[model samples]
Target: MEKTDVEILFEQIDNITETVQQYSNETYLDSLAVTLEVIFYQHPPEGMDEKLQEQLQNFIPQLDVSKYKTTEIRKALQLAMLKGMKGATQQQHLMTPETVALFVGYLAGKVTAGKKNLRMFDPASGTGNLVMAVLDQLETAGSVFASEVDPTLINLAVLNANLQKKEIEYFHQDSLRPFLLDPVDLVISDLPVGYYPDDIRANDFELKADEGHSYSHHLFIEQSMKYTTPGGYLIFVIPEFLFDSDQSDKLHAYLQENAHIVGVLQLPETAFKSEKNRKSILILQKKGPNTTAFNQPLLVQVPSFKETKAMDDILAQMNAWFAENMNS
Candidate 1:
């Protein structure tokens, strides 16, 4: 059987990435960055060992960038990155599942429908996979922005966007820090869960804990809200225990004052390895003059993606709900 586009592209990426990893003695993640950089520039950088440079020069011409579609390229890169991530020890290093990214893209497209030349931002855009996935489904994406504090992730992200010919402005700083950006039309993130270690920075946020370190997920919501345009939508993959934590009361009150709860879709438990790791999608629309709280917020229990009939039925109901509730 002939290889599919994604499979072919993944093989190409894996081959070149492995070549660089083995030659340069770098981690798989770092070597993937070098692989993408060389691919994007169409040449190996200067100051490399002569043999490694010669090897990369040979590989460059063989990669026909124009032959692959953007989605195929993105998927291929995602596969290679996932391989790199297997050795990652930190929780923050994990990428959002492709299934969840696709679901978020669908929701983003639905919520922002009819809007043109939309500006989008992802505050915790690790390696740019989720943002790229969302942009693939958007009809009127205007300017895209993403922030990441980790140097290695940011480098991979820039190369990832460049190889796919995506134009994005990136901030290589802690996302919670202030950005010189104008408010954006939409915000999305797989919010990093755990306590934020910066007590001084924590003091600057309304959701900061009363005594100890602030919950990073809660602080992310506030920070995302601050940068989103009024009436703009924000979607997050949040821990199931978000509202049950000790800081829940403050978070609830803050949301009441600033945004409307649009929906909560409990992701299928089968998506995660354990119940404690399970998460839900929380959708919000920042409070504005033109927006009002929905009388019936969209509450859904998402069916497993493999259950085609059940998934189709749920999506149909969701479409009806959006048409009726969002038309106003």
Candidate 2:
């Protein structure tokens, strides 16, 4: 008997779970675990065949399904497929569906009261997943512009945009370099980490202690502020080390003095495969002279997932919090 699409998906999930379980240390397993969880949580694709199902099932015995939420498992599987399709090496760090969903929900909350036709920008849009997520939540009048340093990633992002039927203006360039600054209502970026492609250059003035000197994140934050409108928001996924490091102190201080630090979401180590334990999302809004003050940072520390219910509960909590603090 032929298996159903849902059955194939389930088998795929099982295979991925097995793969994750095979590794003694949780960190050694592929980051696909998060992708699999996201897939199950969101829309499950249809029409998978038995052959594909069997191939996916091959990896099930390696994962520890008990350690992840259902949504996370689905996301992990989806991410693994995406990586496979892209021919990415084992070292590549692909964004999971859960990350995208979380970002989308945050963007949705950030612009709830803004103009109907918002302008959005992503400085380092890899595969366009983050931009697509933002586009999904914006109004029909919203427009998106994105830049990817890698030509291959640009091609993939273009394909993704086409698949989603989203209207986006994409550029192949290093976003960190100086360029024609366009005014925007929102800027959402996931800055690169560790080693980047050869074409990317560090700013001349910004110096790194271990790495070579480049323009600091302070420069990036300043540049972002320059292009954003007074009431616009800037959401960034930064390395956790930078978030609280001394180098980041000035940026945080600047944000506190000039902008409103709306929220800070500390992601799990599993959020990005490359950095291990240092990654977080900083949500900032450019404040005008009249901007009101909030009591404390809307900080959320998401726990490691081991079940679908946990993921759903986390999402619900985040959504409720956003709704409650819409103005902040």
Candidate 3:
């Protein structure tokens, strides 16, 4: 009996995984990992009925899976299977498609209003969802840079970019490390909170087990400002608790001293219900020394969006704010 194409592909994937595992360090692992993920997602191996399998065999070339690692290929296959098993029930809590639409709309409004030449960065880019959103709204001239610590999640993000046929630079790095290069025009990140898989030591004074080890929304905001050019923007998704915490006071003080609090959008709980987290979008402007005379912060409290109408209301307000503030 002859081996099926699926079996052959699985064998090829295994070979790639073994090759990647041969490398002791992370660099090779990261490179092969992302490539493997892209291949797996592009031609998932699981849950394909005989008809679907035959269709895929014709559509997907056998040579395409040669460049990636087997582990990454397997992981992608597993993810697809898991998602299928959970089905529609898993999607209910996910951020509504409209939420992403509103976000892109707001981003478009900003870009149209002289936020051009935009150099965007997301420090904690997860599966490249927000990064993709920004790219979809901006022009081809714009550049996006993203960093993710989790190798598996980073692979997913790279795959997402490949699926979109977009060019983005992604780094596999711990966000807490000091960036060696200069800042970009904009920094947008959805900060990780509570317990996360990739928590790193906050600083030399902190231990990895310390509560401070987790990436803080305040830290991302503050550190990101350092990388942002004066008059540039830092847009981030943060936990609501950040607004009222002692850390918030410190973050506010830092912003008062270094940047302008441009706006805050209180996202619906549904926005992050899938992740079981509460989130808010904050838009901040890095101020130049000459522009630092403003005495206070601009506080805008946006209501939660429960449906399309609510999202429309939010988009309108965000568009209005961009029109009033951003110059074309």
Candidate with best lDDT: 1
Q: Indicate whether candidate 1 or candidate 2 has the larger TM-score.
A: 1
**Candidate 2 on 1-328: residue-level lDDT in tens?**
9964434555665455444434323332232333243233332223534454454455445434455443443343445446444545522245534564556445554555556777888877766777766665565437778887766567556654543456889878766666575788888876665443332354332232234443345556666776788877888877677655555665556677778887777776665545564567778878976666556767887665555677778778876766677745
- Per-residue C-alpha lDDT of model 1 across residues 1-328, encoded as one tens digit per residue: 9988898888988988898888889999999998888888888988888988988889888898778899999999999998999989888788988888999999999899999999999999989999999999998999999999999999999999998899999999998889999999999999999999999999999999999899999999999999999999999999999999999999999999999999999999888768998989999999999998899999999998889999999999999999999886
- TM-score of model 1 relative to the true fold? 0.97
Candidates by lDDT, descending order = 1, 2, 3
If scored against the real structure, what TM-score would every candidate get?
0.97, 0.64, 0.65
Q: Order of all candidates by TM-score, from best down to worst?
A: 1, 3, 2
Q: After superposition, how far is residue 199 of candidate 2 from its true place, in Å?
A: 14
**lDDT of candidate 3 over 220-311, digit per residue (tens):** 66667778888777777776777676445556666677767766666656655444466667777788754433233334444555566765
Model number with the top TM-score: 1
Q: Model 1: runs farther than 4 Å from truth? A: none
Question: Per-residue error at 130 for model 3, in Å?
Answer: 1.0
Worst 10 residues of 1 by lDDT: 269-278
The list of candidate 3 runs beyond 4 A from truth reads 1-105, 195-201, 204-215, 274-276, 290-310
Q: Which of the two, 1 or 3, has more lDDT?
A: 1
